[model samples]
Target chain A: MQLTSPDFPRNAAHALHDAALQRALGNLKAGFPGKRAAAVARLPEFEALRDLGRDLKNHIIEHLDYYLEQFEASVQRQGGQVHWARDAEEARAIILGICQRAGAKTVTKGKSMVSEEIGLNEHLAAHGIEPIETDLGEYIIQLRGEHPSHIIAPAIHVNLDQVSDAFHQHHQQYGKHERQTEPRALMNEAREILRDKFLRADVGITGANFCIAETGQTVIVTNEGNGDLTQLLPRVHIAITSIEKVVPTLEDAATFIRLLARSATGQEISVYTTFSAGGRRAEDLDGPEEFHVVLLDNGRSQMVGGEQQDMLRCIRCSACMNHCPVYGAIGGHAYGWVYPGPMGSVLTPQLVGIEHAAHLPNASTFCGRCESVCPVRIPLPRLLRNWRAREFERHLTPQGYRFGLRAWAWLTRRPALYCGLTRLGARLLRWLGGRSRRIRSLPLAGGWSAWRDMPAPQGRTFQALWAERQRAAGMEGKR
Target chain B: MTESTKRAPAAGRRVALLATCLVDLFRPTVAFAAVKLLEDAGCHVEVPVQTCCGQPAFNSGDRADARALAEQLIAAFEGCDYVVGPSGSCIGMLRHYPELFEAGSAWQVRAAALADKSYELLAFLVDVCGVEQVDAHYAGCVTYHDSCSGLRELGVKAQPRKLLASVSGLQLKEMEEAEICCGFGGTFCIKYPEISNRMVSDKCASIVASGADTLLAGDLGCLLNIAGKLKREGSTIRVRHVAEVLAGVADEPAIGDGE
Candidate 1:
């Protein structure tokens, strides 16, 4: 939760050279995209559903207050409480207060990016309570004392050996000694260790994918059934989420559910799509006694009706990051925040000040792959551009790049000057190319020359040659 | 879309080449190749007095300059029946000019008009001109890199490939991850060189694994980037624009090649 976004360039350099991290990212490059493509192909209506999802989320964001109020009323009617947190600190304090009131010695958590954003684990640990991450990736990263490199795959930066090392270093507390190399053994060991904690935990915490206004039920979909146990087995259950996750009705939620799993992991539906309302009734065999929902509005309310409003439509399916080549290259930790990739590039600036996370928005190829794959159709490239515009307006851009851009723009306004300068520049470059016809390095563009040759410019500008040919042909045309 | 039996457009369609800044300064052969292809398609071609499409400024968040350049560009190409260009990235910037202006302003309307008339070379050839094949050929096995702008923005995926099929001896050996970016993102490569290097390095690796002796793409920026990386890696694979190959204009040295 420390703001390391300013160190993005350095972090990116480190990630690019980290052999183990690169090896781990290789699996991601091959794995998710193919599966998502096949899943999307199998569902003929996927594109139409994406449109529907976008429209539905747009509607929800527009009528956010109404649906959130309706959700709160629904939760109250179902014998549950809704707690509002204006920011991360407030959210952490509210959750911690609930844990303290419950006399919780330990609490189990499912994978929740909202929790990460709020820095809830450290907040709770700063007090006397211990929090256990139930999801496999989350548990691995928790043992390693690292943040989730990715939104969905928390420990995606960690390889199998790294996982073995994490468990080897940390699992001794559970009376387990051997370092397990196989994934199944690690999973089994984690499950055996977590089962005891799950049974003994006084409170359970989880992040909601959706909180439906109509039914007062919060939804979470997971493959390992960790969420169901984390919420069901504990004495008290708390669902922590951001305000934008609220949807008007189950049908609207269904439209997104159909899009989410396919976009995230290529599953038709995750193995467990658990929906929890208020506390259990007499007929319930296994359920919590107390239920609470905490909604965090950390700088989100200010984004309404702005250029970035579309970002609220994100379902955290992470389709943007998965499809992004930049994310593919450097992985997520380089982003140096809880959110990473295209969504992070846009949102990190909004959440943490743009000045703190300037590189997040500036470091993109604008390939539009993130926007292409977004389920809710967020225009991530455009949004990133919006940040660039803001950064430029605020003069947050680095001075040298800004000056080069400024000088380039100034000359573009003067046709004659631009033409003259380009003609001379072309000849200079051609001469620099000498015989090989490529410059190994450039004066100001060291970044480009550091890795690739600068292709030599043709001797003359196209307009100059065309005009000359036209004159030779006795064609009197406008110059 | 490539039904060659279908009739071509009425002859003498007043198509003006935008001659993107890259083609104007870096590789004028691409513009000439574009002129040859358009003239062969029964269209009248004219080179417009235009330079940069205002993308660098627009992308760098300097809309003031982007709009000023956009205004000048729109005025310069006012009467052309269609504004076509050699680079999809620049033409994509043209298509996006409307977004740079206010919603219903006069500048916005004109920007939209220019955007509507613009087309990338390959898409214009196949879709509008109805040209199925080009009367050109080369013996080398070649791979195509789908520059992101042309592929995603203008739907140029099949246009060049369809035309490439009609060449006499150019074998289109497809490469993996052909649709990925080569990382010459105008200002992006310059600002974040290391990341761009990583991306282009991966792209070069894929091009090598495809085992093609030649590389062709619609946009010169990506071609230059890939060619530069390939050359730096000491590979002999040649790079050229798709238009150059289609118009019989690739007789000169390959991009980034000499002596």
Candidate 2:
């Protein structure tokens, strides 16, 4: 929630050196992409489905206000309420008011990135209301007193041993004393602890994967059924989501559901795809007594008509980060914000000011893998380049980098002069390289030579060699 | 006959070699090999007087400089039938030049014309020239590193491997994650050296795990970065440009290796 993006370089360096984090990241690289490729291979219309998903999101976002109003009316018609929040503060206040009105001592929660963005837990705690994370991954991170390093898998950066330790330390008071080593055992332990909280919580909160305008339904796709239980068992249920989560119809929501699980975890479908519409009906056997939807604008309205509009189509699949080399290396904590990876690089600048999160965009190699694999086909590299252009325009880029780029550009515009200077520099480098033909270190280029040798030039420029060859051919022809 | 008249034209193809700044300065053999490959494919090869492709500036968000360099490149190879380069990244930059100009402007038209005709070397060879297999040989187990631009932007993955299949005694051993970037993203390696170092280190480990004696890649930037890391780790695996290997001019010392 706080901006540590200014210290991204240091954060990334720290993550790189963290052996535990590196071990966690290794599993991420090994697990996600291969499964996604296999899942994609199984579906013949996967790419076509992606196109439909993109178009559907685009259509909805273009008429975001209409869709939002439609969704609100549908909720009201279903005996539910829609609350609008202009920003995070407003959203936090609305949720706190709801909790106070319900006389809630403890509120159970499903995994919600929006809540993290709004600092909801801290706000709730400050107001003397306890918020408990119900998702297994979110609960692990909550126990460790840490933020989610991943979008879908919050505790993905925490290895099994760490989770085992956290549960051991925290679950002692819950009458569970044995340390669990296996994943199944750990899950059962978390399930037992969370099941009690689920029954006792007065109000339950969950983040919606999509809010269907056709039926006023909030859809959440989770591997664990905690979201279902969290919203179902409580006296009151609140679905908190951003405005862009609205779709024109249930069919549009279905199209996105097909892609979300496949892109996020490489599943054809998540185990639990829960759709909750309104309060308990007269015919209903069991459900929440009251239902509410909190729509948080939080700087998204401005992004709708800008260069970053395409980002609103993101399904929070984590596919971009899954395939991102930088994110794979440094993990998400280094991003220093709620969202991380390629999507975060472009979106963070808009959500936080570019001045604060400038490094996020510049930290990429522009590898284009993220764009190639994104289900919505967001041109991530192009957007990053746009951010760089903005950063340059605002004079936010370092002065030394700006000067160096300017000098290089000036030299490149003049061919003969550039060639001559390069020739001399190549010769000098060759001489410095001597027999090894590589520079172990160089002035001002220590960043390159710090970890790897700088390959020296081959002593002669191509133009000079070509000219000599042409001269020799001319002489032979004259003879 | 005058010198110009003495030179025989090859089917009037008039191909111009935009030996990217990297090839021109760091490894001219790649350009030489590119010329040979083009000439062998029955196209007249010309070395146009060119500087950088302005990718450094273009990627850094300096459009004015990038456009100036693009204009210079367009002027240099205006009459050429086709423009080819040994590096996929540079040729990709050429293809992207048209986007830098305002639409419908004269310069925009010229940039589009240049972009339309530009091609990376191997793509031009197999795709345009219709060459089935190159008449070259290298006896070794070598893994090919697909540079990001050539592989992603130009669909260069199969082209090089297709060409390499014909080389006598050259067994192609596929490395794990061969398509992953070697972290030589022009300025990216310098800006984020620590992260870049980690990436290249991973790449080197993969290359070693593949048990290949040599490594080849289309772009010299990635080759140099990978070679530098290999050398730092005292790796015995040699690195060279794919163009050099395919042209049979790979007898020269490997990249980052002493003469």
Candidate 3:
């Protein structure tokens, strides 16, 4: 995933000028948040259940080393292989090794963000292995050759017309009939096209929402049954997930499940929520022949035993993004990464150095909506602020801005100097804002005037008003 | 000062008001409004000589400078009954200070004390101050925007509405996506103007759909954002601080109007 966040003015200009993106963002009004409210309304103890979920995740993250060992043992006992990768390179290498050993012709994949994080598709294609996305949303993006915008709804940024064109172009080549532009029609076409690929594929890869330490089961929740087929039908099944996604017990997993669906899609449960423990056993009628789990610790281990450890408790529900004002307008593309939203803001800066993703932390309005909606109650705004702090302390910020901040901070600490400067600034503004009642353009504030007029500050500062009122009251008392 | 005055609320029950830098400078009416609201509910209100809540410093990555401000704030509000503020951002800063300061430092104990009692105005009114309503009246269809700090950090969602609903002549029309952010964000508007403008534009559109003549919110930063957009777009919809609306003292015409 790309880690660059373009300059504020440039990115803002792009977001404002993009009319199509505006229309795309309109769907958020009735999407995740609306569904979540209805889902929460169904349960009397949703808040209590959230507490349970948060506690469960906290416990797992705290005892992560213990749980990982336990999970590995259980997976081995059940005839599945568990691989630990210290970083993206090792993870990608291990996956390619699995595919090469199997002599895979084609691999069908369910929607897995970990795959995107590791750049698996690109890596596999470079190594001469064909990987096809079977999930409806993933398939749309695959045809268009674009990245997933939203975590859950991968093709959220793509409208029906664009999808219709993709299907019309790809369906005939894949020996499937072209379909109507409707969402259901698009899904049906993709499902029909991928059905045979799923059966013929030598290997299948997926992302786990949670890995149960108690049973060595990788739990996945999906509205469509593609995840089930991707893991079951293929001879070789590989689950790729971050090390943070571990839970102590099935009961703990159940607690998080209550919050996960409600937060992500506002549903009581997804259409198909399946749990696969290990490779196919003798009694199992339908299961993958070989199962492998790759637990990737890509800069996540460092987050433990620190102030940001709470962030690891996230269930990847995407609720924070849905309710976030900054994310709502720009869509996920502006984030320039796989994870886009408040969680992405903090996580991206850490995983890919703050210098590259500096604009992400600066993207927020510090509006607390993301934190309020976060299932784990992560203090997202503060975390983003922490990233900004690191950026400054490391001298990663632009030099001009650093000097300006120093000057401002110097002036702000002293009351007399601050008041004097503010008075001068106010008089200057009053002079500049004569008669028209606005500043059309200013040297320092061009970004502000670009979109809307900078409202002129009223002549007197608050200190002046307060002082005058006090003097008037004193004179009245003397009289 | 009489001992009865000091002892009535008790030492532990004494409340300090962190008049946010914005409240102290831009809108003191909101601060006085908060004071009246707290005092009316029997919590002694103390306006401490607090500087900025370290938000600008903290957000800008000047943690060392932010620590100075935090240390000063913790000292100023030390041994107070409750550390309350009209601004949600200030309350948020207060609550999160323990994590910033060293554990065994003098500032940490003060920060913890401050955090325990730190509540946004509405949350203090509803929870600590035990205020259900403020017996006020206003004639208009008004919609409320939940400010991020107040809604998420302080959990002050229903408190402001509960106060507003008791006003006799006030008619509340729920806005579509009322909980969404208006995107003021202090320096964020200037920093990311296009994104900010687009977000505020979306918020303004939702306010228009609710058809409420007036817009009210807990945080001034958001009100300023929405108000600026409304004013720039030449919309007549009025924006007011929720305290002013709840106080029932707003008789003047809204922005761009003569009373």
Native contacts kept, each candidate? 0.77, 0.73, 0.48
What is the C-alpha lDDT profile of model 1 across A348-458, one tens digit per residue? 999989999999888888898888889999999899999999999999989988998888888888888888888898889889998999999899888888888988987
Error of 1 at A229 (Å): 0.8
> Judged by DockQ cut-offs, is candidate 3 incorrect, acceptable, medium or high?
acceptable
The TM-score values for the models, in the order shown, are: 0.98, 0.98, 0.90
**Which CAPRI level is candidate 2?**
medium
Q: DockQ for each candidate?
A: 0.55, 0.72, 0.39
Residue A399 CA displacement from its true place in model 1, Å: 1.1
Q: After best superposition, candidate 1 residue A408: deviation in angstroms?
A: 0.8
- CA lDDT for candidate 3: 0.79
The interface root-mean-square deviations, each candidate in sequence, come to: 3.7, 1.5, 4.0
As for candidate 2, its clashing pairs are none
Lowest summed-lDDT stretch of 10 residues in model 2 chain A? A470-479
Error of 1 at B5 (Å): 26
Identify the superior model by lDDT, candidate 2 or candidate 3. Answer: 2
